[model samples]
Target chain A: MAGRTARSERAAGTGEVLLAVAERLFAEHGVFAVSNRQISEAAGQGNNAAVGYHFGTKTDLLRAIVRRHAERIEALREEMLERTGDSASVRDWVAVLVRPGTQHLAELGSPTWYARFGAQLMTDPVLRELMVDETFGPTIRRTLEGLNRCLPELPLPVRLERADMARNLMVHMLAERERALAEGAHTARTSWHAYATGLIDALTGLWLAPVTTDG
Target chain B: MAGRTARSERAAGTGEVLLAVAERLFAEHGVFAVSNRQISEAAGQGNNAAVGYHFGTKTDLLRAIVRRHAERIEALREEMLERTGDSASVRDWVAVLVRPGTQHLAELGSPTWYARFGAQLMTDPVLRELMVDETFGPTIRRTLEGLNRCLPELPLPVRLERADMARNLMVHMLAERERALAEGAHTARTSWHAYATGLIDALTGLWLAPVTTDG
Candidate 1:
């Protein structure tokens, strides 16, 4: 039993190191451009097939990276949802939607790779479906339902369109902020908290904005 | 002289074909993942080095693709600006901001690649500078000035933040719509013109949204 535990722990450690290395490399190089072999080599594995051995395939490796971040983000949102309850205002619900991401990034501190990596997945057709399946499951669905419950009067199509807009804005803007933070460049908002505040405010307006033209 | 003119025209024709092929491939595949050799070969050039011979670098090729569209977008916005000429309504200025790209995309008809291609460039760090320099030059500056003139009372930081949000929403949303069209999937708005109208409405609300927390 002791020997088995030791071997399992070592395997877990290797997985963690591979995930970290893969995330950083994917954030630096384009996801499709970086091979499984390169990620394994970067993780200091003597066996080039280490990634295959550990993660199965490149897509599986990408999912592992996303799942790592999504798990934390979901937990953050779940806690926020507890605080919010059914009485949540539009801004509160938007906070539920946006804060998990910014907060997670803030908690991760500098040189984080999740935002850039997530943004790329959000753009890729196959990878986006994988990410949405992983991240936008139970917790996100509940949050959106809560938000929609509050937005009872908005037209369905308009609501859907703005939701799409909000998601895009949230993902892409945070990606930009992350990139800026990594590069030590100037950002208009000083901190992640401030950035989320700005986003929630604008999104509040966006979600509540009157629909003029009907689709 | 006639033979030289014919040769130049033939070369220009090849360059145009290469640009079209490159844009489509870059849109379908991530920009960095697609090679100039692949682009040349995809364009049916016998020499795989044709991309290099025609365009000095990958960035140069990307720029050439952007320049091809920028000229058309610039002309469209110039016409719209002539009609707007310091209109104080936020929506009018927002229209000036949103219309040109969507209108250009609409004019390009179904399965256009520029939006997706441009969105990738917008997200990329090094290429974003090229996109802004090439596309965000004088006309955008003037439009922003006019938009600011309309909202003299809005806080500078809020204005800047909303501007960033608007740009992100515009680029990414158009990219999504473009992708959906390419895939023959459902989209909220049926036409690009309507899409711009929806964007302008949402942006008007976003820009005029009361600043909740002062930066």
Candidate 2:
């Protein structure tokens, strides 16, 4: 048991190093522009096949990075769900979804390459399809289901439309925020939290307006 | 003078043919995936250098296609402005923005490829940056300025946020509608127009909700 634990720790350490190095390279150049050998070398592994041995392929390595970030996001979703419970309002759900993403952006050592990679992936047919199926689609399905249960009075189509609007706002803001950062803007002072809150307020108002009228 | 007019007509005919062929090729296989030779042959032109003579390079060809579509969109915007005149409601503006895009989707010869090209363009940094600077940026700036003049009650930050939401919703809907079409969904049954109207109603509701509260 002791031996297995030590080996697991070593493997995890190696994986962490590889992810850190690959994230930087992929951000600076691009997924297509970078090579596994370069990633191995940068990770300080003398073995050229280190990437394959650990992650199977360059594509797999890219998936791992996305998955790592996604896992963090998923955890936040769960936390938000638990905190808000069954009676959570539309405003509460919006805050839950938006806050974690902005907080992730604010954190130190969060990959600067993710925004560029995400933008590039948006155009990549295979990657986009895979991500839609694997990452975003499932998350969206689950989130919408939860939202629907909470907002039963709202029509499905309307809920879907609002959800789409919220998502687009989030992605657009993230992309713009990244561009601002690249252009040497001080993101620390940007007040993304307030911006997010304002967006939630706007969307919530829209969602509940009809109900208010009926009442 | 008669001879000059005839010559210009001939030039326009060939230009249209080249554009038609270029759109088909670039849509089926991405811009990088398709070649100038393929475009020439597809257009029934014998000369491989025809694309270069007409548009300079592959990137230039893409820019031309984008510009062509953008012009139509600009015309729609102008028509909407003229029809709505000085007292255009938020719903009027939203309808003007959303309706033309759906109409463009419906009218295109190969909507699938056009959509793929659009999705690619949205995420692509180089293409996105260029398109924004040359095409979308001017239109959006003009629209925002117009909106600010008309809807002075809304704060600048709020106006910008709403504008961002509207643009994102359009992009997401276009991409989703295209995907549905690519998967062999019938246009009439899909009811994208209905979807657009729903979005417009929801967004207008959101934007106007605050104003009502303030009043």
What is the C-alpha DockQ of each candidate?
0.50, 0.30
**lDDT minimum window of 10 residues, candidate 1 chain A:** A2-11
Candidate 2 is graded, for docking, as acceptable
TM-score of chain B of each: 0.92, 0.74
**Tens digits of lDDT, candidate 2, A110-215:** 3366656665555455566544444573445665676677778886656765776666567665665665666676543255455566666676666664521211
Model 1 alpha-carbon drift over 4 Å, by segment: A1-12, B1-12
* Fraction of native A-B contacts kept, per candidate: 0.47, 0.34
Candidate 2 lDDT (Cα, whole model)? 0.66
Model 1 per-residue lDDT at B83: 87
Sequence-dependent TM-score of model 2:
0.78
Best by DockQ: 1
Question: Against the true structure, what is every candidate's RMSD?
Answer: 4.8, 6.8
